[model samples]
Target: MKLETIDQVAVIGSGTMGSQIAMVCAIAGYRVVLNDIEESSLEKAKESLEGHMERWIKKERLTEQQVAEAFGRIVYSTFLNDLKDSDLVIEAVVEKLDVKRDIFEKLDQLLPEHAILATNSSTIVSSKIADATFRPVKVCNIHFFNPALVMELVEVVQGPHTSDETAQTAFQFVESIGKLPVLLKKEISGFVANRILGKLMDEALFLYENGYASHEEIDLVVTKALKHPIGPFALMDLTGLDVNYYVRQQRYEESGNEADRPAKTVEEKVNKGELGRKTGKGFYSYT
Candidate 1:
């Protein structure tokens, strides 16, 4: 189907990335269905979207009328069957292969034949989940950066079974929503950004663990010397330590490499339920 044919979009999970993605589609004038099994999470998504709209209005990035219209276009639902008419379904659920595969299988059975299935996973590739559905040609990875409403760069990854037309259509869809789209020629574990980020994080952890410097010092050096926007530890806190831990665990499970395991500090934080900004504590205290 052509990009113009996509009128209804659905985002599953309603978490940080999912909710922001739904709002982004809504602002772009598409009917959006933001789905989550829990009503509390859906309420949180609605509150987050309202806060984003209010901030944009105050900054003059969006008018009050535009925000109102966008809000009106979004529908919250707990039923996966509600996505039956969605022209595009983006899965932003937990970063687990089995869970993602199950969701894809269900979505494939529910959505129209022409509906495109996309995953917003940072590490898991579409190839790993595409086989779970019969419409492998319609499945591809459309990885959006964290804070989806603000981040401009999106990676559209083509799996082994994904059709060329599907990748092109997904790329066009990303552009249609006012985001920069980069094509991944082949499917890889972390796509592009996360792979590079993984290396940086590994080195940063090594430095802190080996007594080269404290995390704070390392972050200061990266920010002041390299002119990076945020230090590695601070970024981890924003992204969630629990998320980093799970991604690393998945990588280790896939490769069976000890080096791919999560850092000790990350594990420690997750064990304590510090889980970064969401929990108000991680490498740094948000409170």
Candidate 2:
């Protein structure tokens, strides 16, 4: 499958990453289908995307006509079968391996043989993800940073059986959408960004749990002192404490080391249903 010639794209799981990816593709002149299990969530996602476009129009970044065209290019669906004609798919489903594996397996069965199956997984390796699916050669990781519509950098991780041509095509596709594409020679856990952030989060967890500083204090030091756009606490709140904790826990177990263990506090907050912005509270209050 040629990247430039790709006619249709599908974004599975219309949450933060999926919806934004669909918007980016639509804006880039590709017909996109954004699929989720729930119809209500799909409606909510369209509203959210419209709001995102409203901001762009307000800033003169996107004209009203452009906004209408972008929204018109997107098709929302509640089933995987809606992606039958899609030439490429970006799965931004839950971080759970089983959930991802099931989704890839279904796509493999339904999609064309040449379709590129990419995962937006931050930490999990693509090879393992491919092992669970039948389309190993077609599977690769196109890990986009948060705010996929704005973040310019994208990491393309190659699985063990991934064809060289497929990897190159992914880079071309990223460039088509005005994203910076960095290629990994091979697959690695976390791709790149999260691998770097994971270490900082580890140390930050120790500090917060050991009483070195409060969450607000920690956030202030990083964002104000280090000039980071956001600190770990703020990031956790934005990313959802439950989601962040799950990634950390998985990475820790994959590392097979006590040092990589997730912080007790992070886990406790998640267990209590304080899942950051989604729940209105985590380390900080959202409302």
Candidate 3:
């Protein structure tokens, strides 16, 4: 298959990653359609996108006019049926194989034969979702970091059946959008960054479980001494304890190990809706 320039990009799921990915595509001059299942979700996504753009203007990273133009290139829709015109559809929904496969199967029916299908799944294997699509050759992973615009690296993971040309097109397009693309030849559990991050978190959880130190003390030691941006507990809070647990659980299920399990404290807190800084609570209090 010949590599085609992505003219219309659809970001399925208007959550944080999806909205940010849509914003980046718009800023890079691609027409972006953000698809979600709820009007409220679209509203939240639009607010999130506008807030980020306002920050750019406030910080002088973008002229007001430029921000306006960028915003103009994006639209929001609640219908999956509207994805018929997309040149590329990226699924950034929750990291669940069943949900992702369902979306991919629907997208395979929606898009044309030449259109590309990608997922923003951070942990699940590309092949798992690929098998659910009729056009498995076009299915690949374009995993962007948390904040898509600021972060340069995008993990371009190709499934076994993914065509080389299709994978290359995805990589080049990601680079065109001002991102550094890392190509993984085959599927690996947790890809790369998540694996490294998970191992570190596991050790930290083990230490805390053993009463090696208090949360605040451990955080202080890591941040002040190791010069990390923040300690593990603080980072977990920022990521939302629930979100972190989901990622860890994905790895644990794949590896079939108890060690990869999410910390009990994290899971209990998440179950109680005591998420993180966004909620003004977590390992530490924001107020």
| Best candidate according to TM-score | 1
Model 1 CA lDDT for position 275: 91
Summarize candidate 2's per-residue lDDT along 179-254 as a digit string, tens digits. Answer: 9999997777877788788778877888988999988898899999989999988888877787787787787778
Candidate 3: count of backbone clashes, pairs at least 3 residues apart or interchain: 0
Instruction: Evaluate all candidate structures by whole-model CA lDDT and list the values in order.
Output: 0.93, 0.86, 0.85
Model 2 bad stretches (over 4 Å): none
* Candidate 1 lowest-lDDT run of ten: 237-246
- Give the number of the best model, judged by lDDT: 1
For model 1, the superposed segments whose C-alpha errors exceed 4 Å read none
Kindly list the per-residue Cα lDDT of model 1 for residues 99-183, writing each as its tens digit.
9999999999999999999999888888889999999999999999988999999999998899998999999999999999999
The C-alpha TM-scores of every prediction are 0.98, 0.96, 0.94
